[model samples]
Target chain A: MSINEIQDSIIEDFSMYEDWADKYEFIIELGKELPAMNELYKIEENLIKGCQSRVWLHAHEEEGVLKFQADSDAIITKGIIGLLIKVFSGHTAQEIANTDIYFLKEIGLQEHLSPTRANGLVSMVKQIKNYAIAFNLKS
Target chain B: MGAITTGLNVQAIREDFPILKTLVHNKPLVYFDNAASTQKPKIVLDTEYHYYSSQYANIHRGVHYLSQIGTELYEKTRHIVKDFIGANSEREIIFTKGTTNSINLLAYSWSSAFLKPGDEILITGMEHHSNIVPWQLACQRHGATLKVVPLQEDGSINIDEVKNMISEKTRLFSFTYVSNALGTINPVKEMTAIAHQAGAHVLIDAAQAIQHIAINVQELNCDFLAFSGHKIYGPTGTGILYGKEALLDAMPPFEGGGDMIKDVKFEQTSFNELPFKFEAGTPNIAGTIALGTAIEYVEKIGLDNIFAYEEELLKYGTEQLQQINGLTIYGNSIHKSSVLSFLLDGAHPYDVGVILDHLGIAIRTGHHCTQPIMDYFCIPGTCRASIAFYNTKEEIDLLVTGIQRASKMLL
Candidate 1:
């Protein structure tokens, strides 16, 4: 979708929900729309150890860019992985390195997470960034 | 199942927890996250209140009346804990901040002596991070190997594999009696037996299990058992370490402080006795005294009763969750604690928890600190509702209704 379309949808999402509860409901609903991942990424090496849901992620750096895929036993968590991939995928190590996930806060969701979930979020980002760092070292 | 004070009436019991009466968004707070930390009962609250108000003084070494009272109360908690867990003696119990600290004390003191290069420390795939990370550090320092016993698809540890995994190289084995995330109740006696045969000391992270199940430390006979009082409806920053008398006597002091030393010379100093050697600095005296009262409250309610009530709640929750479309509960173990972990069809667990919170129902939304277990299930995190004896079927019903509403709103 174009930036205009995305912004319009976000505004619609804000208006669509009546309250924080509704907003969370809508956000979770948004998570439901995320596509499922292939089964190959479900191994321990690819699995993120701290999520409440079993989340698996695989990334390969190809032609100076990184492409990643993620899936989870949980649909909504898959949706979270989907959201993360949308932000981090196809971007260079440098792009991923430079990106700030403050949008989570701007979207008014970070504070809603328990400290445990928040830490998992940090781990997820760190894993991606560390992967980028590893790629940087290799190249 | 028979001893539960479930017949005692939840309304009266709920009244005892001040947090239950507090309103959130004009709704009574429905706290379902008891596996994390239970809210203080009135008895525990009053105990702390009384301690600070009347019995505030330095314990173990005091001449005044207030100090005398403080010392007596503090020492008495050790005895209460001994009776609470069915420990063989009061000397077996050592006070610490919580389960994490107690486990660290064992790791640093004993692991330092026992673990060496190529030595193996056995653990389970279902251990909480607190149980996992400390051993990881110990292994890293000593060049010891870390081996994990595989968990069955239903989240139960494979005891056959546990027995097979034991070897002469195995120096220590530690696992949770009840998994904080999945709520899988491990067979502590059998697991401890396997470790002892392999000549390895076993540390049971009883943090979750002690509150939910009846504990008989002597019967289980593990080398060390650790649990936090907060999980058992006691005050925070207080816990117990139940070690074998010989083990406690042999292990080195965990910290250097005013309480843990015999006599400080310019060159060398002797350490204090069994329990004090491990309890360094000014401990959480108020919390410890309050924990004693908390144990009294649990005993009054009764452990068998607590377990039975939680089992009923778990069964009820599992059945209700099964009715929701696009929902799948994880860890289908026959033997389980009162925690329910599940994934909503298309909703984030955090989103579920957040939405539920607005409805005045509080649930934990995350990995429950067992990140490695989360990895095994192949998800980012899960929505967990941990029930306590104080929770009611009515609350579970409201929780189900709220989830139904949430599912409609989200999916």
Candidate 2:
């Protein structure tokens, strides 16, 4: 699927919820379904540092498409990361680098998140972009 | 549970705080983050609005009608703050941005002049980062040593350790009057005496204590006391650093700018006297006036009344929260204030805070800017419920319910 299509699907999925409670419940459920990262990839080098909740994101290029796995100690953060992963993973590094991810704000995720969570979101996006840049350099 | 005489019409008092009536997530807002910052009363908001609308001007600069009125109101706050903290004179109170700024000012100004190589600055383990980092920087700059007064198991500083630590080389002893993270009310009065006996100066970070307790710099006999306005129902970016007049007069000015100077030549600049020399800028004129009203608002409520009322809330909160299975409270200091720092078993503090936030129960989570204390306690962070006088038993009950809900959901 295209980036825009995936994001639109995510937005549509979130908009199905009537209230914040339902939205959060859905997010938590998504977090539970996120594929677990290998424990070896959970080292400090792979960890995103700025998040209030500890999150580890690992990326590697598979046949010119970027694949990612992540986990978080906090369920909400895990859910948020899961959402990010669903959008950005399985895409070309170039597409991931250039794409503007507005689905968080489109789905009111930014407005719902606390300041710290918002910071965590920003950090997560930056790490993804950094990974894309690294892959671009290697290629 | 035993109750103390507060002599406050708390329901009427709540009416004065417009934010207290606010609803969040379909629930009445239960704000228990007073140590982070207190909600402003309507009187403070009105005072600021009135000042900006009519009485706005650059203070201590212009001779115009508005400037004079602004100067009077702004200077009046100095006198008000002096009386609020029971300082000997208004000259001792130098307004700064906040507690962090105040501490930084002291670190730069006082330490530069007084500290030397091998001299020690003693702070405690439970100190907020604001209290710790400034001294660390100062020590680094001056080639001085920094010492820490270790905490007892109950999170209170061991006074004997402090006495043992303060020696001929101990130049400054700085500590918090109350731990914002732990809520342990340190024995400042006794500690001040000990520091003074060792011929060392003392600085008390009263950011957590000023709103809950009566502060008399003269009575505590501390050389310096720092507190922020926002923590006590005033505007942010405004605070006071109360220094002994002699000490302030001797130290070099922290920053030099207009209003802090008597006259400036191309080469030589003669500095202004106490308070103004340290203040150094166009000052937060509106914020200062608003802080005056905030002090008056709290004074009218009376610190004794606030103390009694908040202590009751603390006690009630402690008892109720203790009933939760696998919940552990930090800082069992016998003389604590209105802070309750706790953790639920098998649950992260961020998860608990998120659950509480959804329930419209505001609390502070994470390290509370005192990472060393978290390290000492062998925890990453805690969910801290810090109360103000406006909080009620009902709110405490909601917090208990919220915690239970969070525990059930997360664990």
Candidate 3:
């Protein structure tokens, strides 16, 4: 789904819930359903350091589309990875590079991440975007 | 969940802590972050006030009435801590800034006197950086070698690996008695014995283990034991270092200042006795007195009962968290302390932590100051909810309810 569609669904779902707990559980469950990409991406170049769980990513521009694959030992981290790919995957390299992930704020999901986890997610997303920039520069 | 005698009234015991009654966003504080530091009871708080209010004076120096009272309270705390840990002598218990400073002092002074070229100092992979880094500095400064005992896949240190790591050149072996991140309770008594057989001094960092566990330094035969008072419901900025009196006397003073010197002359200087030799300058007098009351508060509640209560809470917490479709607990041990680390299947730990906070459940989020453990697991961090004797199962239920609710929003 588009980020706008995801935002609308979350707002509608959140409106249906009375308290923070219900809304939180819904987001976490939604994270669980986020699918890992079908292809493997376990190369050395795309690994994240300082995480307690293993997370690996690979992104490339195929015919100007920003294609990405990722995996992690932690299930939730993988779901978070899937969330990132959702925002960037299938987009043009330049578009992927320019998109402001601050849209995470619009969906109201950014505040819940702890400083380190939030920082790690940002690094992961930044790395993908950097790869897009480098690919654009290379082409 | 084993058969153990119950009914010490933990709920009644928890009532003594006023902070538990405190409100955060109109919700009663459900504190699960005891591993970071525990909430203080009235007695511990009031003890500090009592010192500053009625009897504020410099200890071991002042000669008047208020000074005598301050000295009495401070020295009395020394004896209380000695008995609390079943140490052989009050002289053996030297108050320091807390566990980190204590370890640094031990490594610095002891290695300066004894360590030499090719000597090996062994420690575990599961140690807090405080434990690991001190040895690294000591070994580097003193021409000693640093070696680490490997961690098992379950996060416990393999004793056989420790034995294998030991050599004739081994001068010291230090390990954390309870892992700050993993919550696995190590067999420090047995490990100390093994290190002794290898002809090495063993230092046990009890920073995370001492509050709920009963520690008898004499029985363990550990050469040194360190713990921070803050972890045990006392004020911060105070720590304990229990060294064998003979060893403490033989080692040089860590820092020289007033009260640490017997008599200083322009020509020559002499150091004070065992503890005073190590404790430099005016100490954390208020912190020391407050720590005594914290120990007293724990004694009143009972350590065995506290241990039993926390184990039940951990079991319940583990079970409830596992009931969620894909939440994973890091340390799943039969013999463990209070803290439990885990991650929900579809969210960042920070994200989960933030959601928990929005619901008014507090937990420690991130690497927990043990970056090595996080690196070992290959994740950035996990959310840790460390229970204390005063923490209730009802609080654990609230934690579960919060996490289960947060799970919906993250996934």
Candidate 4:
């Protein structure tokens, strides 16, 4: 599926929520379903700074396709990271690098997140893009 | 004033702050982050509006009617602040941007003149970055050393260690009156005496203490005291740096500009007198004026009553928070303010803060700009619920419920 298609599905899923409580419940559910990262890969070097929550993101290029795995101590942060991973992972480094995930705003996630959490979301996106850039250079 | 009756009409007080009436996430807003900043009372807002709408003019420089009125109102705020902090004279109050700005002023103006190459500046382990970074910069600039007074487990500084730390080489000692993150109230009066005995000038960072406790600079006997306006229900970008008149007079001007100068010539320029010497350029006139009203509002409510009511709230909050099975409260100081910093077992502070936000609760989670304290505690950060007098028992009960919900969702 295209990145837009995945984002649309997420948005449709989110639209079912009537209030912030329900929306956060959905996000927490998403967090529970996220694929866990390797404990060894959760090093200081892989940790994204500036997040109130500790987020560890690991990316490696396999056959010119960048695959990303991430984890966060915070459930909401993890859920957001999972969304970013779904959009950016398993794609060419070039394609991932060129992508801008406007789906957060389209899905009203940006508006939903508190100001500080919004900052964390931005940091998560930056870290993902940074990984893509590093892999793109290696390719 | 002796301990007044706790006749604090919290409902009426809540009415004074319009923000308290608003909804957050479809629930009644529960503001427990008073340490970050406070909601302005209607009077403070009205004062600012009144100044801009009716009493607008440039202060000090103008000889006209509006200017004269503005100058009087602005200068009158200095008097209110001077009396508020129990400083000797109005010359002691110097308006700066905030506590950070006030500290930087002292660091630059005072340290540049006094600090010699081997001199030491001492601060405590629990200081906010504002109190720490300025001295670090000053020491780096002047070839001086920055020393730290160690903290006890409950987060109070060891007074004996502070005495031992101060010596002939220690030229300046600055510390916070209250820990912003941990809520430990330090013994500033004794610390000031120790610094004085060691022949070191002292500066008290009252940014956290100003709202919760009554401050008397004379009683504390500190040479310099700094606090921000916003923390005390006043406007942002406005704060006070109360220095000893002799010290302020002797120290060079912090920033040289139009208002801060006596005469401007091509070859050389002389400086303005005490407070104006520090207050350069177009100041935050509206903010300064509004701060006077905030002081009056606090006075009207009576600091004694506020303190009593908040003490009761603190007791209730502490007892209730302790009941949470996995919740660990930081800073178990016997003497502390209305701040409650805690960590839920196996749950990140960020996640806790986010879930609380969804429940219409406002809290501060993170290092709280005091990374060194976080380092001391060996934790990333904490979820802090710093209460104000306006907060109620019911709101705290709601916070407890929110935390339970968050713990179940996150943990």
> lDDT values of the candidates?
0.81, 0.89, 0.81, 0.88
Off-target runs (Cα >4 Å) in candidate 3 are A1-139, B1-5
lDDT (tens digit, per residue) of candidate 1 on B1-411? 222345556677788888888898679988898988999998899999989987798887878899899999999999999998888888899999999998889889888667789999999999988888888888888888899998788999878999899999998899999988888899899999889998999899999998889888878988899999999999899999999988788778888989899999989999888788888899999999999999988888888877877887788788878988888888888999888898887676865775688799989988788778878888867888889978887888888888887777766
Evaluated on CA atoms against the true complex, candidate 2 attains a DockQ of: 0.50
**How do these models rank on DockQ, best leading?**
4, 2, 1, 3
Give interface RMSD, every candidate, in order.
Answer: 4.4, 1.8, 5.0, 1.5
Tens-digit lDDT track for model 3 on B1-411? 343246677667677788888887568888889999999988899999988988898988788998888888998889999999999989999999999999999888998887999999998888899998888899889888899887777888877887888888898899998898989999888899889998999899999989979889999999999999999999999999999998888798888789899989999899898778898899999999999999988888788888887888788788778887778889766678898899887566767777677767889878888888888888778899999877776777789888887776655
Candidate 3 whole-model C-alpha lDDT, 0 to 1 = 0.81
Model 2 chain A, TM-score vs. native: 0.91
Query: Can you write out model 2's per-residue Cα lDDT over B181-262, one digit (the tens) per residue?
Result: 8899998999999999999999999999999999888889999999999999999999999999999999999998888988
lDDT of 4 by residue, B149-192 (tens): 98778988888999899999999999999999999999899999
Q: Which sections of candidate 1 miss by over 4 Å?
A: A1-139, B1-6
Best-to-worst lDDT order = 2, 4, 1, 3
Writing each residue's lDDT as its tens digit, candidate 4 over A1-139 gives 7666787887887787777777777778888899889988999988776547777888887877878888887787888888888888888877777876777786667753455553355666777778778877876
Docking class of 1: acceptable
